[model samples]
Target: MKGLFLDAVDELAAVFRHVARPGDPPMDVIERGEIRPEELPGLIAGYDFILDDHTALPTEAMRACAGLKHVIFLGTGARSYMNPEELADLGITVHTIKGYGDTAVAEHTIALMWAAARGLACMDAGMREGMWLRTEGVELTGKTIGLLGFGGIAAEVARIASGSGMRVLAWNRSPKAAPGVTFVDLDTLLAESHVLSVHLLLNDETRGFLSAERLAKLRPGAILVNTARAALVDKTAMLDALRSGHLRHAALDVFLTEPLPAGHVLTTLPNVTLSAHSAFRTPEASEKLLRMALDIACGL
Candidate 1:
């Protein structure tokens, strides 16, 4: 099967060339930026498979790509870009790479947690605007941190946090075992943690899983670190929580909209720190992810 590395944005295209090898399938790179949902069918026609990094593939639009049968998503959260089950009905088997960037994302999550706790971003922004902002920050050591899910990334986070002397608490939909981590009930985890790091995947059941009611359950003044999909938390409720000081701060790597619009409300919030959906971006992780996508295409 021929494959197209759809939407080869510079960053991904750069690393993709570095990892692609001689034995790989005939995969063409579309040296364009992100493809919109409406452009999917037109741009993807003629390709039997696509190794997509961050393009939308709506079932309705994708139906127009008559010959396409496979989509090897470069990362785990393909659901944020399209419905795999719906695509499956169209004879398109969506494949995702797992464990490719666990350490990269885990390190980003830990970095966000520390930055939020210490108000680093806020201070940096203030200083850049000619203001000397000196704000007291949260001390993380010996504090309880809650992990909303137990996955490969969370396991790495548990390892790092545990090593740093912070009590790690986790709650997953299924049972899990990790060293130096305490598994707790959702409510217990919510009420006890001083810092809550989100790690749940985005899906029908998980969209806005951290709703207003659930957000209300968090320990007062808790810090929130979200490197996971943005829809996992109720965006509006998160804003209110940050404004009211119910949440001490929120450090996010993902947003409901990519390239979060300039002058967006979140950008204006002093208590929020933002990173361009780059939590899983590291040289090692990018190489592994692209290599894995190539492996899936080769198999197909």
Candidate 2:
């Protein structure tokens, strides 16, 4: 089968080579800095499968690609890139890999939580400019951290937080159990947590789940961390809370808009720490993602 890797930026060529065996499939890379919907068709015309990292495959483009039957997305956020049901109607099955970067993302989430609580980013910037700044950071020990969803990444977060002597609490749409973790109702979790981390998937039911009213229910001076999709939270409400000091700080790895645009309001906020949606970006996760993609393609 013929495969095309669209938007293969960040030195992923070696990963594809490592995962793909000779004679299994012929793959080509189009290393464009950015991909628009208009350029997708010509770039992936004759390929039977397309591997997309962040390119959006709209319904119109998928319908135009007659030879395309499969799309192997790099991560589980395919819905953010393309509508899976719409692509399936056009004979393209979108495949996503989960749990490949669970530990990688969980570790990054913990790092961001620590950074936000301690004002590490701002202090580091001041020190680099030859100014000594000492900021008092909140203690994590004996504090309550609430997980919004209990998935693989959340489980890993719970493990780490519990090990650090922080109390772990979680709320899920369905029931779940982990040793020493408390499962509470949504309202209870919101009012009681010192740190709240979002781990829910983005879908029709969960988009904007953290609305303005819900944001108001959070404990005063609470720290919020989101390593999940940005759509899960109301962007305007979150910004307002951060600016009003209702929320002490936010460590965000995802945004409503990817690349976040230059000079966005979130960029100017002193209380917000932003990552370029790179929580899942580790060498080990990259290898696992490539291997899983190759396995899916080979199975097909």
TM-score of each: 0.97, 0.97
Question: Candidate 2: minimum summed lDDT over ten consecutive residues — where?
Answer: 15-24
| Deviation in Å, model 1, residue 154 alpha carbon | 0.3
The Cα error of candidate 2 at residue 214, in Å, is 0.9
Residue pair clashes in candidate 2: none
List model 1 lDDT by residue over 170-199, tens digit each: 999999878899999999999999999999
lDDT of 2 by residue, 211-268 (tens): 9999999999999999999999999999999999999999999988888999999888
The local lDDT score (0 to 100) that residue 77 gets in candidate 1 is 93
Worst 10 residues of 1 by lDDT: 33-42
